[model samples]
Target chain A: MTYCCALRLKDGLVFVSDTRTNAGVDHISVFRKLYTFGVEGERFITIQTSGNLATTQAVIGHLNNHLELGQEPNLYSVNTMFEMAELVGQTLRKVIADVTQDTHNHEQNNYYCSLLLGGQIKGSEMELYNIYPQGNFICATEDTPYFQIGESKYGKPILDRALIYEMPLDEAVRCCLISFDSTLRSNVSVGMPLDTIVYEKNSLHIPNGKRIYEEDPYFRQLSKQWSDTLRRGLQKLPIPTDDYLD
Target chain B: MTYCCALRLKDGLVFVSDTRTNAGVDHISVFRKLYTFGVEGERFITIQTSGNLATTQAVIGHLNNHLELGQEPNLYSVNTMFEMAELVGQTLRKVIADVTQDTHNHEQNNYYCSLLLGGQIKGSEMELYNIYPQGNFICATEDTPYFQIGESKYGKPILDRALIYEMPLDEAVRCCLISFDSTLRSNVSVGMPLDTIVYEKNSLHIPNGKRIYEEDPYFRQLSKQWSDTLRRGLQKLPIPTDDYLD
Candidate 1:
């Protein structure tokens, strides 16, 4: 299991993904799910993936092959963010199809995976897409400025209530972390060492993203503060009405 | 679909259920999910149900028959809270079995349902049980003092973070509503006109719990205030470190 969330805000994009993956509860391992690559000035792209590890790794490997071979419709050769998302989706679908054919998996989703593709090409608007296991995708819009993939519900309410398209990059990162914090506390499948990226809108260069470890000082402080605040905030909320006694 | 949650606290039990039932989104209707009954001063029982509407209504109807006919194993005759839970579970299983036998539903969960049972029999400690579709049930413990059925995830983080065994009953009710508010905001499957019960510990007489409608003033205040407080609280949480730029 994994928890990956991305915010497509007015400023840019904020992406966070946990590092834990497991075949079973006893077979857990740390695997980075976020990747960044593109022409430094002309195009920038980030991918956060979840689901079958083999499928995601194969998709990423195919993307790397495209980059190395300078193939047409590759991440670098794509004309726009939409085309980039389409390219990734097709590659993902092709990979899943090949694997499914090899294993004769007609209905099972053993080779299925999902991806979040976010980036900006030098000329077009910045964009974000949630690519499904079936390789179809949907982009984030102004009214719904975020896309969450995998173990999404536990961390969604905070984002639904607190996030907005105009939120600053720094604040968006904070919100995503809080969302991740909630998930980490409730689900062991989503572990620590979170990978995060803050892309400045139309900047066309991926900023150095952070990897927040379990003992990271700032994360520790934020989690503690948020917990304390929630307890206090809960108390401050008005009590239910006398109608319960009616 | 429905969302019902119950908290087993040191002070008492808190039960809340949204009043939405839908065969499809187009066929939505209002139906009360929370039911209270017991012999005053001797026992108290509240059942909040979710899942197949027919199964739940049939289970309730059977209980009514037991009570009306003065049956030996009726709710009023149950000697302990555990027996009461067992009775409900067996009845639930029987109802599902009867429906399934009629329809030849051997594999599909067409008649499946879940329930939250909370109350006390005089001379026994208060108890809360989450009865499954299979008729097995698990009671709440000191370590885990809550049970939620149907559309539960959206409202779970707050309870996971803030609820404790020692919370005051009024405050617990407030927390549960806030949880419901989150669910209502995120999932259209769980709708408004919530039915809630706050049974005081050791009080055998059932209180007339509130039906919080969409226009209920205090609930409106609580929901609005919660959104405001959450947004404000998000701002107060510290920003991520400059590590992203590292």
Candidate 2:
């Protein structure tokens, strides 16, 4: 399982992805799910993936192959963010088809993978898109400023209450981290060594970003502080009546 | 969809369940998912149901019928908390069997319901069990003193962070409420009019426990206060570096 989130805010866009993947409990491994591509001061696009590692890697491979070949209608060749998302969706579907057709997956293995695409190309607005495995996608709207994939529910409540279309980029980043921390505490399938990127509008390069891990001072502090605050909050609430006491 | 939770604390026990059932988005309706059964002072057990409303209602009905007939192995006849849980699980399985064989369900729908059973018997300690649809159950542990069923993920993170086996009864209850609030905010299928029961250890009867509705003053205050606290907490976190803000 993965927990990947991307938010499009007034100031810029934020992307965060946990680096844990598992075929089973004993077969767990760390795999970076975030990929970045851009030209300095031109266009910056980042994608955070979740689902079958093979499928995601294949899709990324296809994208990279296109970049190497300078193919038409690829991520780099696309003129708009929407077109880029469609190209990704198409690539994902094609790769999934190629792999499943050659494999003998009798249990009807699910090609479950989702992509979060966020960035800004020159002469356009910063955008966020959640692309599905079926070559379809949905963009974030004013009312919905973010998209989350994989083990989403545990961390969703905070995002729903705290997220706003006009939220400052820094606040949005904090909200995203808190959301990730909430999920990391609850689920073991999602682990550390997070890959996060912050893209300022019209700035095509990832000049401000991070890869947070177990030893990252700020992330460790934030996790501890959030847990402590929640404990304190619980302690401050009034207890039930005497009949409800021990 | 439903959201039901139970917390077994050192002081006592807390159980809460929402009242909403939906076959589909268009077929949604209000149906209490909580049932209480016991002889006052001898035992006080509450069951919160989640999943297919028909299956849950049928299970509860069968339990009631067995009690009414004064049958062997009935809830009233159970001397131990473990026996009580077994009885509940057995009853749930019997109900599922009856429904499955009736020839009324065209799709051969398997019974889909989960139960949270918690309370104290006069001679035994308070115990809580999470009973599955297949009549199997697991008791709460010292390290993990709570169980949640149906639409559970949205509320899980807070419980993961705040709950401990040694938490005070009221603090646990408050945490449970916060959990429910989080679920309710994220899932429209889980709604208001929450039935809550708090049982004191060795005291088999609750003198002041009741259902909380949308307009309940304390709950209203709790919901608002929790959201406010979370927002304020987010505000205090340090902003990321302004390297990308350029």
Candidate 3:
């Protein structure tokens, strides 16, 4: 399992993903799930993938091949973020179809994969999309402003409660880390060494992205602080009186 | 759908459940999911249910009939908490089998139900078990002192972080309510009024349990205070610095 989330704030986009992959409890491995495509001063794109690691790798392979060959419909050639999302979705569907063609139990063989794509095109506004396995996608709106894939529910309440469109980039990053920390504590399948990218809106260039490990001081401090804070807050809530009884 | 959780703490046991039931988006109703049975001064048991309402209701009906008829091998007749869990599990399996026996599409029908059973038998320690759709169940341990069913993930992190085997009954109850509050905010399928029960060890008689409604003043204040505390905690966390960037 994987856990990846992207936030499209008023200022920019934030992408974070865990790098833990497992075929079963015994067959666990670390694999990067975040990929980036960009042209300095023109456009930038980030994708975080979940499900069927082979399929995601194949799709990324196809995209890389297209860029290398300067194909007309590659990520580098797409004019807008919407078109880029469509391209990713289509590529995902094609890869799954090709891989499962010889299987007699196509329905039972779930070679499906999903992705969160977020970026900015030079002349257009920043955008975030959740692309499905069937070549369909939906963009985040002002009310939503975020997309999550993989083990999402454990981390969702924090995002739902704390995220707002106009929050500063740094604050948004803090929120995403807290969300990831909560998930990590609850799920063993989602491990450490997170990949995080912060894209400043309209900058059209990827800034320095961080790879956070368990030893990263800031992350360690944040995790401990959040836990302590929650415990303290819970302790402070007023206990119900006998009036609570029926 | 529902969200029900039970904690087997050292001091005693605590049970909490939401009262939301829905067939579809347009059809929603309130139904209590918590039930209690006991022979005062001898034994006590609490059951919180989730999944198919019909199946759960049928199982409960059978248990009630057994008690009313003074049948052998019934909840009252069982000698140990494990035997009681087995009785409930067997009854659940029987109910599902009866309901789906005539259906040609049994697999598609989904006559599935799950239960959390926690109680004490005279001279035995308190126990908690999570009963599955099949006639099988697992008991909670000191390391994992709580079990949740139906729409559980959204509320799980709090339990994971704050639950302790030795926490006071009131503190455990507070944690359960906060967990329920989180689930209520994120899921439309889980709602209130909530039913809460606190069982003190060796006390066979059931105390006056609380039935909390949306308009209940203490519950309302607790919910508001929790939200405010979480927001304030998030604000107090230190924001990341440029050192976070590569």
| TM-scores vs. true structure, each candidate | 0.97, 0.94, 0.96
Q: What would the per-residue lDDT of candidate 2 be over residues A154-220, giving only the tens digit for each residue?
A: 8899999888988888888888999999888889999998888877676676665678878977877
Output the chain A TM-score of model 3: 0.96
Where model 1 places Cα greater than 4 Å from the true spot, the runs are A102-106, B102-107
Pairs that collide, model 3: none
Score chain A of each prediction against the true chain A by TM-score and list the results. 0.96, 0.92, 0.96
Query: Candidates ranked by lDDT, best first?
Result: 3, 1, 2
Model 2: CA > 4 A from native: A101-109, A238-246, B101-109, B241-246
Candidate number achieving the greatest TM-score relative to the actual structure: 1
Structure candidate 1, residue pairs in collision? none
Model 3 lDDT tens row, B1-246 = 899999998888999999999999999999889999888888889999999899989999999999999888898889999999999999998898888887777372478999999999889999999999887999999988999999999999989888899998888888999999889888899999999989988787676689988998877888888888877887888888785643
Q: Is candidate 2 or candidate 3 better by lDDT?
A: 3
Q: What is the C-alpha lDDT of each candidate?
A: 0.89, 0.84, 0.89
* A87 Cα displacement, candidate 3 (Å): 1.5
In the order shown, the candidates' DockQ scores are: 0.71, 0.51, 0.64
